[model samples]
Target: MKCNKFLKGISLSVVWITLSICSVSANENAAEVWRFGLEEIEGSVQDIYAQAFKRKIEDKSQGEIVVEIYSYGMLGESEDLTNLTANGTLQLTHASVGILGAQIPEAQVFTIPYLFSNNDDHNQAVLANNPAIYEILGNALIDQDLRLMTLYLEGDMVWSTNKLIRKPSDFAQFKMRVMNSSLVIKTFELLGATAIPMPYSQVYGSLQAHIVNGQTNPIFSIEEMKFYEVTEYLIWAGQQKFTTSVLANQAWYLALPAPHKLILNETIEELTPYIFEQQIALNNTQLAAIKKSKPSMALIRLTKKEQALFKTISTPIRQQFIQNSGQPGQRLLEALDKALATEK
Candidate 1:
């Protein structure tokens, strides 16, 4: 009987060992999941892009890749998301140059007011994927342990203010909410407003509570955040374009299997034009919604002369950016200029 019991135990041990081996093999071949984060909520350009990317990646990989999305504040603020991505805690994130500026100082060049022309072709055709520009920005990002997947625009930034602000002088009495970036603060300060550096998440409350009289963002942001309800003016001065960089954890990206890497590159290229069109549609629809909801709110588009006045003061900030970012920042600016000039 004792011999029979020992034999039964050995049989059970073999069964357990076989199960363990199979489990390990299944896990090895299981689908890989990627986390994609957005700095804006649903319906924003970032959200649209991420959704398209998620679909394409999953489809192309035939279930080998899966994407889980986190949109605005789900994983914390913009800077936090970038940190998570850089450290490999988050696989990917969408962030503005200002958010990236904290870690990648050279990225501050994009925060320079009027840096790109107020033309779609200039922004989309040239600046979006400019080899000269990304080559410099890419090196800067790699040092920060981030990879630039793509650069995209939400829309032209407009001021949601309590009053009309057509010229720099008109900003005399304004308290403008700017991102927590020195360049952005300096840009608004140069424009004659008392720039208050704050997190993007806090801007709505600040505006509603009168902590700040105004903030600058794309038309979709004003509508999405319902800023138009509190602010009395929508001033389109074209101070800057809201360019967001899609980033990946550099080390993780480098380690991706060759096919996975190919899938990502192909996916981004496929969605580029669609993403641009969606931004335009969102801005147009949202702007109309804001005006229809608040007929009393003024929609102020600055005349060329009025915009030029603000642009002139903005020039000094470019020199300031070069000083802050040093040689690399200077290169990025030069690259951007070369691309824009080439396009022109």
Candidate 2:
């Protein structure tokens, strides 16, 4: 009886040790989740691209890495998410170049008017395939504790107003909502408008309340935000072209294993073309749909000469951006121009 009791105790001890070992191994093999944040609504281009990224990462990583997305300001607004990404609290985020400029001013290079004639031109000039321009912009935020993963041209920006704005003087005395960007603000002011900087989330209510008479954004944004509801005119002024970037927390990205980093970079390169195509398609479709659905709303397109006049008016603003952007900003602008020239 004594021998049997002693053996039973030993067996129980062995079982406990085995269970502990298994627990440790299981913890070691568990996947690491990379969280992504998007300020846009679900089914929006931002959300769609994010979901695709999450899927690609998971499938390519074979369950070793998991990508979790928080869309529609789930994690936070652009500013909050930018802080989270910089401080390494969040793994990744997507934001407009203008929004990212608040964190890394060098990103404003893309806001230069006529940087590309259209989305296709912008894609060909500054996408993952073109390392010359891509690397400069991508690495611009490394010092800010964030790293740019990729860039997509959102679309051409247009002015939507309650009053028709056919010329630069037409913008005078009118309140125009703009992103919290000095370059954008300066652009509106140069065109003779009162530039009111506001967060995108507040734009609709502000329009309703007449806090601002008008705002500028891509066709997709104008439609998505339903600006036509409160406004009477959509002006295709093509004042500024908008581009957005995917950014990763520098610390988190640097800490990734070599294989993991390879997987991420490859996945981004593979998926960039699709995202760009989708953006172009959505912009075209929404532009047409908005015009159709809001037939009562005026859809105004400036003649080439008229657009040239606006560009001439904006030259000073461009200079202001270059001067304010500092030496690196100058270099980036030059590099971008060089790339564009080469493409031409």
The per-model lDDT (C-alpha) reads: 0.82, 0.76
Best by lDDT: 1
Cα lDDT tens digits, model 1, 54-170, are 999999999999797888877666776776676665688998988778667888887888777657756787656678667888887777788888888789989999887877888
Which pairs of residues collide in candidate 2?
none
Candidate 1 segments exceeding 4 Å error = 1-29, 342-344
For candidate 2, report its TM-score.
0.86
For all predictions, the C-alpha RMSD in Å is 11.5, 12.5
In TM-score terms, candidate 1 sits at 0.89
| Minimal lDDT window, size 10, model 1 | 1-10
Candidate 2: global Cα-lDDT?
0.76
